[model samples]
Target chain A: MKRKTDVAGEAQSEGGLAFHPLDQFQVQPLFGHGPIEWYTITNVTLWLALAAVAIIFVFVVGSSARKMIPTRLQSVGEVAYSFVHNMVEDVAGHDGAKYFPLIMTLFVFILFANMLGLLPGSFTPTTHIAVTAVLGFGVFLFVTLLGLYKHGLHFLGLFWMSDAPLVLRPIIAVIEVISYFVRPVSHSIRLAGNIMAGHAVMKVFAAFAPMILISGIGVLVTPVSILAITAIYALEVLVAFIQAYVFTILTCVYLKDALHPGH
Target chain B: MTTTTTTTEAAAEVAHETAKAGMPQLDFSTFPNQIFWLVVTLLVIYFVLSRIALPRIGGVLAQRAGAITSDLSAAEELKQKAIAAEKAYNDALVKARAEAAKIVAEAKTGIQQDLAVATAKADAEIAAKSAESEKAISEIRAGAVEAVKEVAQNTAKELVAALGGSDDAKAVAAAVSARLKG
Candidate 1:
């Protein structure tokens, strides 16, 4: 109770009346007051480490028993494994199974990070464009390199849709090339944008929670804000899982393009 | 009011400084650290999954599949045994019924044979009794014929004596005997 009042006082002292909802996304050095150096450990690092540890706990330690009948935690691990496994296989075909581990790693990492962010005061590493951009660019680079290696110069054929009119072939090829390069941008933005928007909205609704102290209309607005927060929180949970799925399946789709570079 | 305004100005400066820091995600300074950790964490997870977790989980799944297949095969074997047992039971039952019918038929024939022998023996005894009764009846008829001859001879002699005719014993005997013979 004392901590709550102190935090409220701090917020008031810091111009709480003009609270910026996006302030929650600010990254700062976890240690002594100083500019964040490249080597400085931040909240992003802490939460990301926690997310990785959570994934390892569920997958590695939970399945250490390797029981023929899975425990609850092991079942969760297996479901995640099979879910990504099927995605890679179904979308990218048997050739995609080879990359299942890579795709699975991305999925578990992002999934845990997203879900962990739902905890109050926890940082969401996935909401950052930097992290998502890394993943997207990594996938883009991997697929592009794989396609080039496998098909050599023939890989360029993917850009040319032979079904189109020969007169329009060059134009279509240009469009395809542009879209192809745009994959990483859209991929990173989609996940980071969705996660950031959901978190920001939640924070906005939470900011209105202080309206309850306004006396006259506080009582009515308080419940409505609380309900909105609850609703958005629920939606964010769905968004977290959906964004992870969307990212993984899209990776598989790009892998398919690499594997089969034809129309 | 002046002190309050100064405090407000100070707060605005702080807020401005915070805003100047901008979105941490956009902060170019933090990228290397976040990316570094991301690579490190991803590499760690990848190693764990690829080296340890996935293979173990896959082994469990494979073992489960093997167990199911073995169980199904065992069930199939047991079903075959059951079918064979049922067939053997049916065969034994048929054999038992046939044996019972054979025994019944044999028993019936033996009884009929004994009955025929008894009937034949009874018929032989009846035939013998009728033969002896007929012989005795013939003997009694012969005796009655001899008595009747003797009487008839006596009557003849009396008749003769009353009429006052010769009454010689040897003549009378000879005449009587010759008339009887005739």
Candidate 2:
């Protein structure tokens, strides 16, 4: 970090373009400055709570009316409800539908967190691997345990494709087993990487937004950078929703494997 | 949000005293905090959703679907009733038209019967009056013929007296009768 700061300072001296794109991702204390303990109420806590509140706003208050003829707010709740509902049913199949609330929690929580993080100067909980790993591995652990409990040793048949030639079956099983274990890692990283990259790039552009204050060349750089920022922000909104959706659907896919490992 | 300045100087100094640190996500010092809060958030979200929100929203959706279905059936029933009413109205209209035609036919038959009787009575009266007129004409002819006969007989007698012959009324009458007969 010190080296990064020195490099940024040198860039500032050279072209007046000092910016820390990754700085936005730093977890900080929301209230007071100190060493962060396990129970410390940091920005992650505040934002996580905000995400929960947003979930409540969309799920609880949005559906508080329960109107037969739904108002706009109720429609929002219903849309989110049906969207996740259909995704679960579609990907996880009928037997996996009982786990809908679990999937909904993940989708809504991640969705709200990602969206709120898009606000300027706000922290994104999902951008942290620690947070996403909890989500990804939570699904992973649940699915593995459920599979092992339900099918016992038969669950291992998921990796052993019997239809393959005897010569290739062992090789295929090894690959399948390894890939199966890698699901949570890829799942968590895919989301965090997409969000972090988009945000970091936006920060990079935003850092250039003040170029007009520095040099005459900023007349060109400032508007272009602002446009880039706008474009990336728009894309981030889409990415935020898509990542949540991706996470939820992947959870469903994994849930399907747990329920019926034969496929 | 705290920048790298505060993050690098203190948090990293306390937890991870690595000579070189790169990304904040990689900073293991904050992992415990993030993991702790994430667990809490997920737990809260899961409980709230499963207990309250999911069931409530699901119930409302199911209820709305039920309402729409029932409303459709009711609309279909009402349409069926409207169709039945129109059919009934058409049937009544047909019956009324038939009744009116029957009444018009009955009134026409009654008027025709009366006209037939009146025409027959007028014909009979005219026949009777014409027979009476014919009888009067026949009587006048008969009387005129008798008067002409008498006048002829009186002239015959006068003609005979002028010829200085005797007046034989019976012979003259007989001769006139014979001449008339011939």
**Number of the predicted model whose TM-score against the real structure is largest:** 2
The alpha-carbon RMSD over the true interface for every model, in angstroms, is 5.0, 2.5
Q: How many clashing residue pairs are found in candidate 2?
A: 0
Give the clashing residue pairs of candidate 2, or none: none
Instruction: Show how many residue pairs clash in every candidate, following the order shown.
Output: 0, 0
Structure candidate 1, residue pairs in collision: none
TM-score of each: 0.81, 0.88
lDDT of 1 by residue, A131-234 (tens): 99999999999999999999998889999898999999999999999999999999999999999999988887787787766555668877998999999999
Best by DockQ: 2
Per-residue accuracy of model 2 over B40-90 as CA lDDT, tens digit each: 999999999999899999999999999999999999999999999999999
Supply DockQ values for each candidate: 0.34, 0.47
The CAPRI category of model 1 is: acceptable
Model 2 DockQ, alpha carbons vs. true complex: 0.47
| Per-residue lDDT of model 1, residues B5-51, tens digit only | 99999989766565444566677767887888888888998998999
Residue A205 in candidate 2, Cα distance off native in Å: 0.6
For model 2 the TM-score comes to 0.88
The 10 consecutive residues of candidate 1 chain A with the worst lDDT sum are: A1-10
